[model samples]
Target: MGSSSRRNTMSDVTIIGLGPMGSTLARTLLKNGTNVTVWNRTREKAEQLIREGAEFNPEAAAAVSASPIVIVCVANYEASHNILGSHEVAKNLEGRLVVELSTGTPQDARNSETRVREQGADYLDGAILATPAQIGMPDTPIFLSGSEAAFRRSEPVLKILAGNLIYMGEAVGAASAWDLATLATTFGAMFGFFHGSRILESEGYRVDSFGSMMADISPVLGQMIKYEGEIIQTGAYENPQSSVKTCRGTADLWLKQALEAGINNEFPTFAMGLFNKAKAAGYENEELAAVMKVLR
Candidate 1:
């Protein structure tokens, strides 16, 4: 590690892969006084960092061996395996801490965890939730899951990389599972807003006002999330603040509105169907989150 805020040519960390995300990770560390050793198949992708005092390793194994703490953010699980699954790379990875901050499936993380552990490496799998520009920002987060030992060893450096560091659990796939679930939530909300905006635009209504309305939704959403968390953990969705049947009433109104507007009602229809499923199972009095049971 460099100074609390001083990075130089002698990097304390090695970063494998210089794709947009990887390169940004390296530069963010460099800017925050953490020297980085970088490697990429395309030598030129690391030119800027090389000038910023990052050691350019032409070989993947060499990059893996450069520092005790190595971070990988590559194209995919296959590419990750191709780069580090070789015997040549494995030889240098003994007792090393490898944090994979790449977009991959839960199974991908589990597979990589097994392979790296077999080679005597400490593995931590992660999913970055922010874009390249948000790498070192205060609110940017990345979900992490792996051995507790691996996570503890990487925490200091990781905190320098991201403002919010969420440690999911020892299950290597936990982080990816949460990442996908979060994405579903994100896209679901976005899709609803997109459809609403389009529907309004189609009828010469202003969509700009919806932005402020959505901001107001943020807190309501936080409360919903908190309520659901308790409900799920208890496994007793009984006596909800707002019962499934009650929400279904609003869901019905939404479906009718979408129909009247000639807008696609699929989203509302799908939600109503879920509510109906819970009601059919005689859970109409439980919290809306009770529908998760049917989901399983």
Candidate 2:
């Protein structure tokens, strides 16, 4: 039988929340032939998914009771708790596995794990590193951290929702930590790209062309990712091979240009802070990664 056929043959999977991400996940489950029971605060949001073969339940407790695997992708930890903490839902969740894909701080994830466990449910914290469209496609990275046994038990179903799923150890907080770190890197790189694009546009250059050219630099980013590990492991930011001072000068020039362009200088300004700190610390002659110390 196909994966969808196998899923349909099984019992059921329940989902809470029907936002873009939640709806996408539900759709993927439905396509895989998994019987899905869904609940959302606003009932109207789930109507489309219901038409797509999902069973929409107005009662959160009924949804939880209908499935062995309960996936919650609400707004945050508090909202997730608000939905699941209902006495009826909590009471019916015993013996079920609850996988949370909501965005939250590491501490929040840890706390949620504890709270969910208190209600006699196994908790697994998950972080979806892709947009709605990428779910279930190859290369969609998802992080999971919690009970090893619980993860192993749900891996088969979870694989249907992630292209690249990683088990991030047993700490419920690990997935959230990875999520936060990854988001920071992604946002930082995007801000840099946006700043660069704006600067080029101000100079009458085609932003689209600049973006296409930048796309060719993906390999360079891969190298930078490797260097990040070296920086973390060796605590050696200063690359004696390529003086940090040289990098500082380039950063200063970029900052100056940003200021002159009347652009929000937050990105380069923050970068300059690290470069300036490293320069003041006498690591000017070190490699660019050496500036990471100042950043930390």
Candidate 3:
């Protein structure tokens, strides 16, 4: 049988929110032939999904009891806790699996797991790494952690929403940790890209062309990062292909160009501060990865 047919034979799901992400999730599951029960604080938000074959449950507690698997996607842990942490909802959670797709810190995941387990339900923390528009695509990723048994129970239904299901072992906090760490790296590069765009604009270059160039060279950039990561992993900061001093010089050049072009220098200034700390600590001759030591 196809996955959709198998899902029909499997357990139903309860979706406990109706925001963009939650609505997309419910729609995906409904498209896959799974019986979906939906509830949101704002009941009107569930209207479209209900018209699309989702059964609407007005009360949060009743929604939790409507399915064997409950997926909670809310703004944050605080909102999720307010919805599911109540005695009425907590009591209905027994013998069911609660899959939390809300964004939160590691501590929040830990606390949510504890609360769910206290109510005799299995809990799995998850982080969806794609936007609402990406849901149900074969390449869409969802990171999950906590309660291997719970994961096994919910895997089929979860796969309807995302194809790439990355189980991060039994640590309830791993999903959130991985998500936040990846976001940090992504945003750090994005800020630098923004600064680069400003530089190109000052030089009268097309920003779209610069973006396309960056996309083309991304593999090369990835390789460079991999090399530095290995060096950092082994603490082999000497015999550098690129030294801290060399990078510092680049930052200095950026600052100089920013001054001449009369543009914002925040990116270069921030970079220079870190390089100066490494230089002051006598890592000037070491590999660029040695800056991690300064960070540590």
- Per residue, candidate 2 scores C-alpha lDDT tens digits across 1-296 of 22233233434788899999999999998899888888888878987887788877788988788799999998999999898888888999899999999999999988998888998999999999999988989788899999999999889888899968899999889999999999998888898899888888778899889888878998897787787677768877544555678877878888889778876777778888888888898778877777766766
lDDT of 3 by residue, 11-45 (tens): 39999989999999999998888888889988789
Compute the lDDT for candidate 3: 0.92
Superposed on all Cα atoms, model 1 deviates from the true structure by an RMSD in Å of: 3.9
lDDT of 1 by residue, 1-296 (tens): 31222333335789988888899899888888886888888888988887786788788887777788999889888888988988889899997899998788999999999999899999999999988988887788999999999999999999888989999989999999999999988899887788778667768888888878888789988788887988898897877888899999988987887877787888788888999999999989988888889888
User: In candidate 3, which residue pairs get closer than 3 Å at backbone N, Cα or C atoms, i.e. clash?
Assistant: none
Consecutive 10-residue window with the lowest summed lDDT within model 2? 1-10
Clashes by residue pair, model 1: none
Between prediction 1 and prediction 2, the one with superior TM-score is 2
List the global CA lDDT of all models.
0.86, 0.85, 0.92
RMSD of model 3 against the true structure: 3.8
Worst 10 residues of 1 by lDDT: 1-10
Point out the higher-scoring one by lDDT: 1 or 2.
1
Task: Give the best candidate by TM-score.
Answer: 3
Q: Rank by TM-score, descending?
A: 3, 2, 1
Poorest 10 consecutive residues by lDDT, candidate 3: 1-10
On lDDT, the leading prediction is: 3
Query: Which parts of model 3 have CA positions greater than 4 angstroms off?
Result: 1-11
